[model samples]
Structures are given as C-alpha cells and as structure tokens.
Target chain A: MTKPNEFAPAWQVAEAIRSGDVPAEDVTRAALDRIAALDPKVNAFTDVTAERALTEARQVDADRAAGKTLGPLAGVPMAAKNLFDITGISTRAGSKINRELPPAEEDGELLKRLSAAGAILLGGLNMGEYAYDFTGENDHDGACRNPHDTARMAGGSSSGSGAAVAAGLVSLALGSDTNGSIRVPSSFCGTFGLKPTYGRLTRYGTFPFCDSLDHLGPFARSVRDLALAYDVMQGPDPRDHACANRPAEPALPSLNEGISDLRIAVLGGYFSTDGMPEAAAALAPVAKALDADKTIDADGIDAGRAAAFIITNCESSRLHLPNLRARADDFDQDTRDRFLAGAMLPASWYVRALQVRHWYREMFAKLFETVDILLAPATPFPAPLIGQRTIEIRGKEMLTRPNIGLFTQPISAIGLPVCAVPVFSGEMPLGVQVIGAPWREDLCLRVAGHLEKEGVAVAQAPSGF
Target chain B: MTMSDDDFDSEAFIRTMAPSLGLSLDEERVAGVSVFLSIAKGMADILDAAPVPENSLELASVFDAGQTAQQAKAE
Candidate 1:
C-alpha cells in the first residue's frame, strides 16, 4: 500500500488511486493535513477547500467502485491561483480592493475542466496584489514564503502556486503569467511551471492583467505533471477570442519521446548579462545534459522588454481606471502607483511600443526557423531576501521589484511557450527556462524531460516537508 | 503638466499640472505616481532610441507552416 504521507508525483498518485492501494480520500486527507500544519510558515493558500476536496475524492472512489474509467489525473489534489474564480468566492486576486466584488458566478473554465479530469480543488492559492507584482510579497494576504528557506522570497505573482507544490501541500496548481508570474515563482520555489503558448489555453473566468499578454497555465514538481496539466486544460473557447480555434494536442503521448533529433542552444548576449554567479552556474549542467552547443543572439531584447513594460502599463491602467479613481487607497501601494503612471503615458508611446512588439515578433519568427529550442535563466538571480529591495548585479544596483522579471519579460512579451525547470546549487534551488518557438511546447518539454532524466534539473522538495 | 523643459521634478511636475488636468490626487498618491512614471520614462528612453523600420507597424500574426504540415500528416 502507498503511504499517505509520501510526496508522490501526480502521475503516481493517480495510479495509486486507480489500483485502490491508497484510497483517494486518504491521499486528499493527507494533503489537507499537511496544508493545515505547514501553511502558517509558507502561506501558500488563501483558502483551503477541505469540504470540496473530500467530496471530490469520495466521488473518485465511488466511480472506481462502479468500474468507471478514470481520467489521467484522477484523484490528484490541485489548487488554483486566487485570480481564478472558485464559484462562491469574490476572486480577491490578492488585493484588498477586489474583495468586495460579488462572488464569481461559477468556477473558472480551467478549474471546471481540471475537475472533469479528476483533479480535486484543494483551494485558491495566494498571489501578488492584482497580479502586477513580480516579488511574492502581498499586502492583502501575507507574503508567500519560499519552502526551502522560509525567510527567502517566493517569486510572484504566482506566489503560492509555486510554494505549495514545493512544500508538498499539493502536487499541482494553476497560475497565470503576464510577464513572469508563473516562471518566476516556479524558479524561486524550485518547481516546474508551464506557460503554454498564448492563445493556447482559454483564459475565461480568470482576472485580467493585460489581455493581450495574459496566459493561464499550471505548475507542478515534475515535467510530466506540467505537461499533463497543460494538455488537459487546453482547447478553444469563444469567450476568450484570443484562445485559438485549434484541437487539443495532448502532450502526454509524446512527453517521453526523448530529445533525439532536437537542436538546442543557450540564449547569448542579453541573456548572459546581469546574472548572479550561482544563477549563471545552474545552466552549465543542463547544457551538458542535452549537448546544447550553439549560441543564439536575441538582439533587441531590451527594447522588447521595455515595450512589454509600456504595454502592461497602458492596458492595465485603462482596465483599472474606474477603480483607481474611486478607491486607489484600497490597493497595494506598488500596484497603485504603477497603474496611475501608466494612465499618464503619452498615447503615441503605447502605440509605437505595440508596433515595436510586431517588429520583435517578426525577428523571432525568422530566428526560430533554425533552432528547435533555446535555454535561458528564468530569473537573474535566486530568490532574494523577503524585504531586500536592491540587487547588485556586476557592481550596479537595480530595484528588486521590477528587475526580477528581467530575463522572463522579453520572452513573455511575444507569447512563447516556456517551461521553467528547477536546478539547484548546494542549498538554494534555481531554474532555467526551456524556451520553444511559439506553439512548440512539445520541444521545450522534451528537453526538460531529458534534463530531469539526467538529474541535471529536478524539483527538490524543501526539507522537513 | 507636460515636459515643458528639462526641469522635471516628479513631485513638482504632478503638483503643478494635476490641477489643470482636473485630477485631485492626494500627496501620497501623487508622489507615488511620480516616482513610478520617472522609472517608466527611463525604460521608454531606451525603447525610443532603438530605430524601427518604416512601414513595419502592422501586428505580426504568427503562422507555423511546419506545425501545419505535421498536423496534416498525422491526420
């Protein structure tokens, strides 16, 4: 019989539940018990749906008794970021200002689909206020702590999604990435997170950060779980016009296909600069594991990052115009100031920046014609101390809040699929993004799987979990 | 209100120009927004310096012929 307290992968848990060796209820109960015991230190959850989780697990057990076929993630415990609506909660979105809005009419589309795939909702996870933050510190909810070292930061805005998985509170959770919400948190907390291609997964029922750039996806401890969660949650939706009208290409069947004919390289030039020694050191083993040789120069990345910053400012500011005017006092100070500044930007700058985005995307298109995958450090450095503000990279100090997304922003700006795979030094865990061409998540996952198999990249659960 | 010259004190700029623009901002809010704008303006300066080609303003819609081929073959 499988041990209830064991930290098993989602795939293993599903198989255990299927074989009736460990009942789904016992597994769910163990996860809930862990959350209750350790969440005070980690602050990974804003809410824990104990009743809902037990109910879902019972149904899975009942189905197995009746000889019904189980889904790929049957009986797997999961949670969603607070930005996702959970039917009866006022999608607080990690902000004081949004708490009073009426409860969401229904669960977000992603949750509904995951439930159908037999993943139970443990609850909603904590996030940065209004999802505008890169650092995991939240003004409304407490700061989501790194599982490895409680005093260190868990990068956000998908703060709790990463910490929970790393702490073994739950095996899977969902988070959104506008710039680097999913990837940054995944890096800091030492977990695997997938930011699927923009327009790949439907974004219906999630809080909007920047509609043009918003992408919803999953986080987990293993690459297989990342691909499994992504494959199940994807498809077309009329409500999210940005979601492409394409059939779901399930990644499970090809996840273990290996990186046989794949051509991989590390991003040079801009990606090489501003990295901490430890952060830069994490990439060497991954390169050796996949035999990645060629160096690709991604020119104009700085301008792309700046353009993304402007677009985020312009779009998010407009979205919050009504709320900002009425109750700016209710918002986190960091979120409030950025929105107000964006509102004041010259219209010409926003438009010109969007045009520049087009130029940059065109450049990537031509560049992707040759390379199959590109690897880059997910964050410039490992998780900073919880309250530390400035990062000294090569003698120059930069603000910690915005520069945390330095490496992630440029890739996200153009809507590419990136899988953040955890790598480690002596104690702290770091991550490198296995990047793919737009809609080529298969290649990225293949490379990530290769690294995981080689022990070069793997999610190390925080000690004492 | 605007960058009339180079004498750009963030606090003074918002304080002097906010009234004409009909925005009644508290001192804290104005101070916050000013600092945020100053940082963003620094980023915009880097972008504004990068030379973009003429007539390349249309949004680039991505198309993957290779994926299309792979899909068709699978079918």
Candidate 2:
C-alpha cells in the first residue's frame, strides 16, 4: 500500500481501501502507530485494541481477494466511548467500579452493526465517569485533553471521542450524548458529532445515564462521515425497548441535497442570550451561509433545561442507588454526591418535571412548523482551560461545567436530532447545532453538509497531532 | 410548598435524607451535593409553574416497557 490517506475522512479511507490504492492493514496499522506516538500527549484513548483491529483489517483484504461484497464503512478505523459494551471487556463508562463488572458476553448492538458494516473498532476511548459530567476530566482515568491545545478541554463525557477525532487519531469514534456529551466536544475539539433523536439508534449494550434523555451517536471529521456512520448504525433491536420497531432510516442518499429550499431559521430568545462574544460570533457565518434570515422564539428553554436537570438527576440517581449503597466510597465524589442529591429530590418534583417535558416537547413542535432546521450555538464558549472552573459569559462569571451545556441541554431535553457542526475562528473551534424536528436527522445532516461544501465549516486537524 | 428557598438548607437536608437511601455523607461531599440539589430544585420550580393540560401525566408512559415512546410532543 502506497500513499495511504491515514488522516483522511473515513469515506476517503474506505474509497482508498476499496480501490487497492491502500491496503486495509496499512491504514489500520498507520492509525495504531499514530495513537502510539501521539495519544500519550492527547490522552484520547483508554485502550488500543491493536491486535483486534489488524485481525479485522486482514479479513477485509481477504474478502476483496475472494470477491465478496464490501460494507459502506468497510475497512475504516474507529473507536467507541468506553461506555459501550465490547465482548471480553467490562464496559467502563468511565468509572473504577464499572470496569470491575464482568466482561460482556457479546458485543452491544451498535458495535455489532458497525462491525458488520466493516468498521474496525480500535478500542474504547476515555470519557467522564458514569456519563454524568460535562468536563472530560475523569477522576478514575486521566483527563482527555484537547488536541488543538493540550491545556484546554476536549469536552465530555465524550472527551476522548472529540479529542481522538479532532487529533485525527481515528476517522470515526462513537460517543453518547445525554446532554451535549457529543456536541460539547465537537465544538471544543473541532469535529462533527451527531446526537441522533433519542431512540433513533439502539442503546442496548451501552451504559445508561438517563433512560429518557440518553442517545448514542458518532463523532467524525466530516458531516458525511457522521451521516455514513449514523446511516449504517440505524435499525431496530428487540433488546432495546426504545429502539424496537423503528424502521431503518438512511440519511446518506440526500445528505448533499443542499439547504437552498429548506426553511432554515436561527433559534433566538434563550439561545441568543448569555453567549460569549466568540461563541456568539461563530453563529453569524453559519447563518449567513445558510441565508437564515428569520428567527424563532424558543420560550420554554428554561423549563426544558430545568426538566432535563431534574429528570437526569432523578433517573441516574435511581439507577446508581444500589451502587451508592454498596460502594459509595468507590465512586467519583462529584458523581456520588450528584446521585445522592437526586435521591433526595421529592417524588412530586420529578413527576412535575415529566409533566413539563410534555409541554416542552410541544413548544419545539410548534417552532418546527415553519422551520425545517434550527441553528444555535452548541456551547457557551470554546474549550475552556483544563482544570479551570469558571467562565465569563456575556460579562458574567458562571460555573464552567454546568453551563457548558447551556445551549445543548435545552434541545436534547426533548430528543431533537442535532448535529454539532464545527466553526473555525483562528485557533480554537466553536460550534453550532444543526437541529431538526424529531426523527428528521436527515435535515440536520443536510444543513451541516451544505456548510461543509460552502467552506463555511470544516474540521481542522489539530497542530498537536 | 416544601420547595421554598429559605427552607432549603442543603447540609441539613442531606443529613435528613441520606439515611433513608442508605448513605452517610462527609463534609467534602456535602458542597457538591448542595450544588446539585439546588439545580434540581430550580428545574422543578420551572416545570411546576408551567401550565399543563390535565392528561400530561400519562404521556411519559410511552417510555415504559413494551410500549412505543413515539408519540406526543403535545402540540
């Protein structure tokens, strides 16, 4: 194999592998080599399954020689957030105790689907402990740092996911976004991340954070890669109640259909407020590129964010109660304390929040009537300094961690399909969420792809890589 | 009604609530617990004040087992 595009997007890599311009083993080995050389500084990987990856690569070459059909994602190197179950290793979900659980007997549904599509999993990447964090600083595992600047955060709990993709460590990686886990890192690390509608993809083998809000999706260097990964991973699973009976929906066919005829609108009100100048400034070019001239009011943002907070706390706390009881000392202090707090919430409040969720979803439904897509900032600011605690947003100091999700939480609260598209401004990358009506991830990807084609948005490989 | 800001003392509240959930809290954990509880409470307040139709309670049942959670954003 000569001149393999090691840092190229997954689509390009697949094209190369298919044409015999580059051997699958060469591409896979190149990725493993890069990880060995740079991952120490980036902290993007918790484990690198080099042997498994090469073994899978060998099959691709063998299949081609024997004249077998290739999958859409065939021969691509990828990794998953540590939360997803892989056979023979306990799903870490970024925690000491979780890693102690027995090894999974079978791969999770998502992993199985990706593998069938010919995407080789390099290994699991690092994440926030228990999927309850916004910062990628895992207490058990080391912090996943930004590839653009080692001193900055990659965002979390999908920290390693964002860093790995942005650093070009892999062409594709998977991350779960309950509240901006995918988008936050996408914005900070300059990668494309998708949080498909809740239940759009099966979450059967992944560790749960909140049943109502959890979503499993991908992070990639291009919108097409995001669409390709999502399209391949779409289908139903009997094991995941949320995923059952949902017809397979593919977004790749219309991904480049352009947003010229689509009624794109910028989300205003709560979305426009409290953004730092740099963060707020990033949205203008995206809106201008799409010709987004109209603004829609999102009145229930506060209620939605509040409901998300309550529901996430209550549900996650309940899920971890047994652990909290048996081994509270073993859990991260912040995670344990948050769970304890959720346990203390009144039952009535949780019920009331659920009621409000219905109301919140309706508000978004009404907003979507005249809008095909909504554009909003993905984070209040770019990646914050590692170990830094507070940020000044619109001239007011705010806690860095909770406020990181200020824009993302409201949208995900009601399970909107949002693709976090990166916007470059000099050094660090900021992002905007290309949001669509429920089950309309196609529209979001279309808008993101349109921006990529216009050269208005693109993921820049970090210099550190 | 028990959601009053003045009535909420996080330390005292956790002390009272921990035993029921089989927990023992240390001071280091208290500050973190305090922050989270207040955020949870803040969210509850907004949802409580929002107007809702009488049948809103049953909408979330779709998230239950053997049921399709595919309907009702309530327009």
Candidate 3:
C-alpha cells in the first residue's frame, strides 16, 4: 500500500490497479485512511461511503481476477458534490430544506457514467446551499475550508469538491457550475476544474439551480485525470431536454497535440477590470507562455453578468416558488432570500435578459472567429476568509459573494466551455479561466494542457493536509 | 419603461413569488432578494438600452449536434 504521505495521480492509480501492482482493495483502503486522517481538518466531505467504497473495490478485484474488462477509471476513488444524487442518498444540495426528502432511487447520470468508467464513489462533499452563493460558507453545514489555509474559504457551490481533490482525500470529484461554482473552487483550492459548455453534460439527476446556466464538470489533481473523467462523462441524456444530441469529442488526444501556433487571445477590457491586482498579475506568465498575440475586448461582460444574474434569479425563483411560499424559514437564510428576490423578478426583465443572452452569444462567436481560446482570471482573487462579507477593491468596499464572479459570470452566460487552471502567486492560489467556443471543450482542455505543459498554471495540491 | 419603487414593494413582491417556484424563503431571505432585485434591475436596464433585433434570434440553432448527443448520454 502507498504510504499516507505518498501520492499518486488518478491515472497512475488506475494503471497500478490494472497491472495488479496493487490490489484495488488496498487503493480503496488507502484513500479511506487518507480521508479519515485529513477530512476532520479540511471538512471537505458531508459523508464518507466507507462500506460502499470497499464493496466497489472488491468488485473490481473480482472482475480483474475473472479476466473481465474494466473501465479506464476502475478502482480510482472519487466523490461528487452533495448536489448529485447517489443511489439511496438524499441529495441535500447543501441546504437545510431537503433533509426530509427521500433518498434517490438511482445514481445521477453523471455518477452512473463515472461508476461505469470504474471510479469508486467515496462519499458526498459539501457545497453552497441551493448553489445560491459563491462562498462555500454553509450556515447549515459548516463552511468547507481551503486546504491551503483552513481559515480561508474554498469557493463554492462546489466548495467541498475542490477541497477534497486538493487535499488528496480523493483523486477526482464532480462539481456543478452555474456562474463560477466549479471554476471558483478550483481556483481557490489550486486544483484543475473544467466547466463544460452548458448542456454539455446531463443534468437529469443533479439538482437544478438555474437550468439555463447549470453545467456539471470534474475537479481533479491533474489535467489528465480531469480530461479522463470528462471523456467518460460527455454524452447526451434523453431525460435532460437541454442536453444537445452530440457525438463526444476526443479530448485526451488534443491534450497531447500541444497548443503551439494556436491563435490564443488574452481577454482584456471587462475581464482585466474589477478584479484584484494579484489576479491580473497571475495572468502575466500564462500570457507570456502562450505567446498570446491579441488582446480581445469582451465588450459586454459586465452587462452579461447582470443579465445572467437576472435570468438565474428569475428561473431559480420559479423553481422554488412553492417552497418559498410554504416553508421559507426552512431554507438557509442566504439562499432563501436570493430565491425570494428571484421570485419577484418582473417578466419583462427576464425576457430582456434572455434577449441579451442571444446578443452576448453572438458577440462571443465573433471573437472566437479570430481566436481559438480566450484566457482570463477565473475568480477575482484567492479564497477570502469564510466569514468575510466585505472586501476592499480599488479603495471601494464590495460584497464578497456577488462580486466574486465578476470574471466568471459573463463567460458562463454564453455557455462556453471553460477550464479553470490554478496558478500560484506565493502561497495563495488563483486561476486563469480559459474559454473555448460552444462544444469546443476539446480546444479548451487542449489549451489548458498546453498551459500545464509550459508550466504556466500547473495544479498544486494543498500542503500539510 | 421606467419603474418606480412604488410600483413594487420589491421585498414583498419577491416573498410572494418565492413559493410558486419551489423556493421557500423567510424573513432572512428578504435581504438576498433585495440584492438580487437590485442587480437584476440594473442589468435589465442595460439590455433594454440596446434592444436586440428579432433577426438576431436565429443564432440559437448553432449548437453542435454531435456534442449534444455525447452530453445526453453522459447525463
């Protein structure tokens, strides 16, 4: 068995299991041991599926012994943010309101696909309540801590997904992004995360926050592991109307193709503005590494964010209207209020935002015509303190929650595939958001792989876990 | 069109609308609603400034069918 401090990438673990260098049960036990030793301090998981993990691991061993074929991810331990339904587990979505709901009948589509690929579900991780907030601070469940600094926020609604992967408790974890959930946590935790284009993955069993903006993606310790998980998870689902019927693009091949001579653009104007100086500074190396030749202006990013917020609120309110009317007090105070406000949105405003969404998407298409990918900061800064409600930016105090997505919201509005590549400036972790045209996750991941190869923004697991 | 504060008691309006959409909110939820309202209202104003032509709506059909199919299976 690998020692507690010894770490192996997900691919390495899978290969070891496949070659019988280490038994699948031993790998499962090692991950369980790591979680037992570190989760108390990190607080990344809401539940640990110890019994189920062992069973799955043993199944893999049995299959291998019988000379049966195993999936690529067979025996690799991972977790999903609590928003995803695991068979027999209630998907709380990090809220107090869903505690009374019955356990799910089957695994969410994403989970089913991952399991089919041989990933062992370790347990459910924590997240922002109803995915309404950017900070991982949960009033019901204690906030998930950044592995780098326990007192700092991990960024959410995929908070625990980032925390678990970064702290080495799990090799891979799934996170849902609407706005910046997947990217933000990855940025804060110094892990690699991918937010595939909207409707790029199935949302059949995942709890909905805003149907239009929601995206499910992977968080992993390495870009390759993230690519592997994403490869297995990319496909259409009949149950999800938003899911487009498309053939999967082979992302792993593009990763090896390299990104030299690719026409990459560094997003200027809106993305470069309204963020921390460190965030802009972190992009310098990536710009130099990619030899980025153009500075593309994202003309309506601010406006896009506004429209996204409006649409998200209006749709979210519609989704929760019944609960808001009958049992409003049961919700996490922050999420409840956000939903109520969304409920109050005028129909005209929602319509206007939708109309603007069309315009914004066109604007992105025009930009992509000249560039393969656009690079910008993922979150404005590294994770702030868990309880920090306000932050000073350019001599002005801003609310942490709403402003955190200044760089993320606009890109998501157009449903572009984005890879959040973690960059380190000293001890704090920041990320560069690399965006590709719709259904161009291959291009996004390829550019991310290039960045990783050039040592621009390599993933770094949090120390002292 | 300009909407005066009097036209909607933004807080009360949101509270009433919350339950219809499967969201449950209470007194504390009022604050978040207010923030969202403020942000949404500001954004709606921006979109209204440059009204998009109806012809621009044709772009929604540009999605990748192959990618959509792969995503559906993964879902």
- Complex DockQ, candidate 2: 0.43
> If ranked by DockQ, best first, what sequence of candidates would result?
2, 3, 1
lDDT of 3 by residue, A1-465 (tens): 342232567888888888788888988998999899999887889989899999999999999999998899989989999999988889899988786789989889999999999999999999999998789999898899999999999999899999999899889999999889999999989989999988888888988999888889999877899899999998877788788768777698778787775788899887764446778777878888888867887677776777788888888878887787787777887787677666777787787787788787888888888888888988877889988999876568998888888888998988899999988976698988888998889888888888888787777766786
- lDDT by residue (A1-465, candidate 2, tens digit) is 345465688988887788778878888899999999999998989988899899999999999888888888889999999999988889989999987799888878888899999998899999998999888998888889999999999899899999999998899999999989999999999999999998899998899999888999999998899999999899877667666467888999999888878999998888884447777678989999999989887787888888888889999999999988888888876588888899889898888878788887987898888889999999988899988898898788988888999999998998999999999975789999999999999999999999999988899877757
* Local error of candidate 3 at residue A30 (angstroms): 1.1
TM-score of each candidate's B chain against the true B chain: 0.48, 0.66, 0.59
lDDT of each: 0.87, 0.87, 0.84
lDDT of 1 by residue, A1-465 (tens): 465354678988998899888888999998898899999999989988899899999999999999999888999999999999998889999988888999889999999999999999999999999899988898888899999999999999999999999999998999999999999999999999999998999888999999889999999988898888888888887677578879998877788899878888899988884437867788878887888888888789998898889989989988887787777778887688888788777777787778778888888888888888999999888999998899887568988998899899999999999999999965788889999998898878888888899899989867878
* lDDT score for residue A239 of model 1: 73
Residue clash pairs of candidate 2: none
Instruction: Mark the 10 consecutive residues where model 3 chain A has the least summed lDDT.
Output: A1-10
RMSDs, each prediction? 4.6, 3.3, 3.6
- Candidate DockQ scores, in order: 0.29, 0.43, 0.39
Location of the lowest summed lDDT over 10 successive residues in candidate 2 chain A: A1-10
**Which candidate gets the maximum DockQ versus the true structure?**
2
Tell me model 1's lDDT, rounded to 2 decimals. Answer: 0.87
